[model samples]
Target chain A: MKVLSRLLQIREASILLFIFLFVGCIGIVNPAFTSGDSLGLILKSSMILLVLAVGQSFVLLTANIDVSVGSTMGLSAAVCGILLSHGVSGYLAVGAALVIGLCIGAANGLGVSFFRIPSIIMTLGTLGIVRGYMLFYTEGRWIEDIPHYFKELSAAAFLGIQLPVWIGGIAAVLAFIFLSRFSVGRYFYAVGDNEAGARLIGLPVRFITVLAFTFSGLSASIAACLFVMNIGFVPNQTGSGIELQVIAAAVLGGVSLSGGQGSLFGAALGAIFLEVINHSLVFLKVPAYWNNAISGFLLLLIVTGDSRFQLWLKGNGKKKKQEQEDMNRSKLPKSGEDGYEDKVVL
Target chain B: MKIKWFYRWEFFLLLLFIVEIAIFGWISPGFLHVNNLLFSMNDFMFISIAAIPMTLVIISGGIDVSIGSIMGLCSIILGVSWSHGVNVWLAVIIAIFCGLAAGLFNGLIILYSRVQPLVVTLGSMFLFSGLALVISGGSKASGYEGISGFPDAFVQLGNGSFLGVPNPVWFLFVMTAAFCTLLHFMKYGRSVYLVGINSKAALYSGLRIKWISLSTYILSGLGGGLSGILLTSYFSSARADLGSEAVLPVITAVVLGGTSIIGGRGSIAGTVLASIVIGFMQYGLQAIGLTSEQASIVIGAMLILSVMARQSSFQKVMQWFRQRKSNSSDLMY
Candidate 1:
């Protein structure tokens, strides 16, 4: 009971509660929504986003952003897809994709950390460049010749769920543990929470930032692998606009974009929540066009409400402290009161 | 580091513009035609229009990524209203007001919530774009086809010209002048700079920092709305995806115009000139037979190179390299 209460006390617990309520409402409207098959499908569909959101959460933890994640995903997927089509071994193709992702991420990290360029601008520059390069390399054409074995990887189930889902779930769990229980993982929070303090305390702040982005890029590559396998093809616009969605998912999951807050589980849950919203829109028969608007509106609503709630909690704490101070004053001796009166008068 | 006369960015941009025209004209003589040069402004006037207000947003220490989607939303709003038999002019006004409300929403949420402007605007960007799609999908004109056949007066707003210049060019000039006056010749402009430089100091000095920051967002939304209308007029169609690809170039123009992304250091004149430079660069790229995707690579590179060149650290590094080279030469002597 104590453990349960402690879990409920977390900021993400509210989000978890909201998700349950939301799913319950949807289930009430459409019984199919609660079905194991549908729920599984939602989880499967959100796996890519879950991974991306986790990666994005790391960057957010470091108070930096990588808008190029989507483009990197597309480019890496393109490379993997093209290499696979050319009969390259799966390991080589996947390795190339991950390396490409790491290089792009390293470039973004170097520009922001070493060159002193703003993260947004540097990543935006990479977004354009990577996207353009992918388009050019693909000759503005889609790759639809993915091998059957590659596509089968997404189909292969472990414990009644797809391989990718299990991979994503395990990745999220590992990341959560890594970010929470590990000393190196804690450095991300320290760096973002107080860069100057971290530096003064002998932390390699720049290297940590670069590591955060590299992790983001690596995760994006993993997402790309899953994306290509599931779709069995790669389009030039494979990950266009997914950056916003991934960031939204991370921010929605209680990851503060301003840095030094949030967790991987929250981001995974946020990704699931977003997928549920998308899935439920179809189930509820709302026009598909309303999906983006609804998701965005809900994101705004939740963020605003969450911040207000924090502010209220803070105010409540201050008031409690003030009342305690008053009570202590009332219990003070008369001579101490005379000293306080003299100080006030002075 | 002292900047040489040749290193004055705005002046250099002007020179670059002239050189661009000369080179493009030499490659394709028809590119130099007065009508071609003037009318080409129509293609990117929306970027110029949007960048003008963006200059202020960046100057006020905030960013609005939603203007692109807001542009699309406002355009769809005007189109949907007009398609429903409302007067075109009235629909335009309604659309502009909607932009104002969106901006107000952004400003209010950012101020009270104390969330980073980047994250707030990022969310709003998605919201506005999604709203645009919803509005369009609900309207009679659905799917890939856009609403068209606007009244002549409304169409004239985008295409009509006076003194042999396109209406968009005129609109761009007028808006630039108005924003320039508001930013350079007014106290409100000073407050914006002060707030950006140090919000706490500005607050202590009796400035309504919130209002000034909020007003910049409102102005940005106004620009987005106006650009949407102009785009619809120019193309004679209104689509939900109008200006969807605009955020990058608009920001690039502002940043290239010498506006510090970190805020408090920028100029209206710089933004205007930078917009023209970028607009012409795109046109000239296509004129030289490069694809738009290819052109974007150049634009992206330009954005990074320009900003990096402007960094104080970059200058220090360059000075260090030069000093090292001189020291080596002295050893040789």
Candidate 2:
């Protein structure tokens, strides 16, 4: 019962419950949505976002944001796609893309941590610079004609599930283990919870911040690779506006924007939930144009509801603790009298 | 004479402006013409207008990314109402009210929900833009088929000159003066800075933190609304995506003008000067045949570089370089 209560108290449990309720409601509205095929499609479509959200959760865990992730994804995919079209080796192109992503991420981290620029502003600047440069480099054109073998990688199935889903799932599981079980990984939480206290405790706060961003960039690159494979081409506008979705996904998964709270699993689930919403809208025959507005409304509603629920829980806990204290005080006098009566009888 | 004007960031910005003008003039002689300078103000007028309130928002330690979308929404509102036979002027007023309401929504959500301003504004950004698209009928045709054919007077409001200066230049000056007085000379302005510097302390000391923060967002919304209306008139068309591209440059202007994103330190003068510098830079770059995308790369780099240059760490690194130079000279001697 205690374990069950503790599990129920976790933010991930609530997110899971919300997802189940949402899926059930959608299923009731359109029975087709509940089918194994449609559900699998939803998970497949969410793989890229799931990968990006896990990376984002790292920076969020450290109380910093990386708005450049979307652009990073775009630039890397552009490079990777262009390379493949030019008949370059697949592994080489992928490595180059990863390196580019890492460098951009490191630059963001350096600007925010070393130069002391605000992470949001720093990343915003990079977002523009990177996007603009990519456009300029490509001359505002798309990179098409990617190699066939590379494109086939996304569709290849493993154990009856698609490759992208397996990759996203593995990334989330690995990140969950690293974050929860590793001592060094705990530094991100500590730094985010209280920077001054973390520094006072002799933690490398700046380095940890940089590491988190680097990991975020690395993940964006991985997502970019998947994007190239899945889409088979890179548009100049690749990953544009996707930062909003990734951030929304992380936040929906109960990752506090203020930082120091959330998990990789929750973020991944949030990604899947967002994808499901997108697909469900189609299944429900909603206009495609309404997607943006509906998603925005849902984000606001969920966040407001979650915050209100947290406040109520806090208030209830305080009241319960007060009652417990009052009960203890009343029982203390009776216990004292019983001890005295026992002594007299003796 | 007692003031060390050289030490101020605004002074540095002025110097940068002079340097930019000299360089641009050398590259394109026509760029130095007064008429050209005033005419080019039309290109970035919306950005400057929005940056004015954005200055206040940043000074209060909050950000409103939704302002750009608010501009779009207000523009659509003005267009739809005017087409529906309402007086164009009344439509503008109604549009401004919509902007205010959107801002109020943002302020209330951030205040009551205790969510970070960034997240709340991000959500609203999409919401406002989506509404704009919806109200405009979500047609790809709307790209070029936006509402047009406004009355001559309304069109003249955006393009006409007064006293040999463009109307936009005048608007910029007036708005700058009004906000300058509000930010630098008013008691309410002091409370904004106080709240931004330390909200907890400000609250304990009897400051109305909520009102101060909320008012900044309202003003920002008003600025967005005004930007949308002017943009509509300038182009003689109203589209759902009118100021969608303004967010980057507007923020660059405010941050470049020395408004710390962390809040509690900024100036209106700096923002105006910085916007002018940036506006001219873009104009000059385009005059020299650079694409808009290339210009964006320059602006983005400039934003990051300027901020990095302002950091104490950068200064320390410079000092260390100087020391190394001096120490190496001594060893050689």
Candidate 3:
């Protein structure tokens, strides 16, 4: 009973268990679903999404979102590709990408924090503006013929895993540690939990808000780099409309849309879960077009369930408190007049 | 009456409008011609028309980003229905109803499920776009070829002039007047304002907040449907991509008109005038040898600058300057 109750407390654990069950079901349908090569490919494809989800988790934890992450990723990739093609070293190109990402993220943060623009509106504007710049730079052309060294990084495996998987692993571990062990991480939770209170306590409210977006930008740039390496080319549509999937992943991983409680590990698991589900559909020979509809429906279900569960938990907590109060009152042995007065008070 | 005039943002917008027209007339003699102005106005009529109810939705503390897709969906429905020997009027009604259904679905999901409007609408944007693609098989519906046989009266609704003004422009005027009055004068309008300002307080005051929000989305759908119809007739072609470019312009017009994105404050008249401003800006820039893309950069910059200026701190600085000037004049006296 204690274990069952504990399981209910950790909502993300149940979601992870559900993902494993889904994998098992898919494996029964097609053994290829569980093969080493397929698993590796899934991990590689999910790496960029995983990174973006980590960033999204942070912003969403603070009751905000960064819809511009996908656009930032595209912009960064295009800048990196253009610079690399101009004979810039891969390292320099990567650095340039990070800078571009940081600038864009800072702009968004400033709009939201200083100018008092809502994060969604600010990010929505940047999403278009950045994408427009990318279109202008690329002239609607895909970037192919990347240097062999960059492509090799994506292709090479360390200890039977792709480079992207390793990168994802490191990101997940680092995010988990920062969120769990550091004062800054706790500050993020505190801000998300209650901004007014956090401010009253003299937290660097505006700076922390900006830092969340800066982290988001850095993660998006890193994700873009990984994407360029893995995909071997950058298309105009690269990362277009990917914000939805990343947000969906974070939400599905038990990140409350209302803000405050979530885990980076849960976000990573969410990305993996989505990838596995997509793979399962392909393995089951479902039409590719149906995937969008199915995934959208699943997201709606999960989000609705999370909200209902939160309400239920709150209701149960209230009810338990009431029961405890009732027991405490009943414990008093009373004379008739005293009992009558107690009943009137109740 | 005095209070009303002071509170209206439209007066300021109208001043801007007159100033722009005068400047453009001076810069380019052709801009003074009625035909040239009307032609330029016609280009953005779709966005102007859609912005009316979009203003209401945003003012009510929600957004309907799916209107672009809703317009596309309606156009396709109109095209398909017309090709099937359906009566044109009936086809239009059906098209409008289709848009309403889409909006209703968005409203239901957002209100009943308590999902964030941004996320729900974002998902529906893709859903509606995908549905349009599937229904049209990723091809243009070819309104020019398919709708050639539409009656003269129907076509005249888009092209024919009334009192020397284009019919669509006149239609825009009528709708703008109706919406502006409805939003500013009616009891329902007051409720919508209250709901947008503080939904919890509105609920406590006995307003059916959900229904109010739901109705705003429905109004947005109706507006999108009207735009879809006009676009179908004007372009003489209905395609799945018809109005895809209108989303940014619509949002830009609203924000530029000083509508708060966090909701509760907006004006229909301001939006209408802002749309005209944008229309003129697009035309003026194009006249000066800027491509559509470059024009977009100018519009984006203007939006950012306008938002920054609207921030309260900026207002305080201006007030301070005015106060300093007044104090110095007193010293001189």
Candidate whose lDDT is highest: 1
Residue range B225-317, candidate 3, lDDT tens digits: 889889888876566667866776898888778777767888888888889987888788788766565566566656676566566665676
Question: How much does candidate 2 score in TM-score?
Answer: 0.91
Question: Lowest lDDT 10-mer window, candidate 1 chain B?
Answer: B1-10
lDDT for B109 (candidate 3): 75
Candidate achieving higher DockQ, 2 or 3: 2
Residue B291, candidate 3: Cα error in Å is 4.1
Give the clashing pairs for model 2: none
lDDT by residue (tens digit), candidate 1, A146-195 = 88999999889977879999989988888888999999999999988888
- Residue-level lDDT tens digits of model 1 in B236-305: 8999899998998898889888888778889988888989988888899888877777677777777777
TM-score of chain B of 3: 0.89
- Model 2 scores what on Cα lDDT? 0.85
| TM-score of chain B, candidates 1 onward in order | 0.91, 0.92, 0.89
Collision pairs in model 3: none
User: A1-346, model 2: which lDDT tens digit per residue?
Assistant: 6566467568789889989999999999999999999999888889999999999999998888888898899999999998999999999999999999899988888888888887877888898889888988788899999999999998899899899888888888898899999988899899888889999999999999898899899899999999998999999889988998899899888887767888888898888888887888999998776776777787788777777677666556677876878877764322211101111000
Give candidate 1's iRMS in Å, 1 decimal.
Answer: 10.8
Give model 1's docking category.
acceptable
lDDT digits (tens) for residues A223-255 of candidate 3: 999988888789987787788789878877877
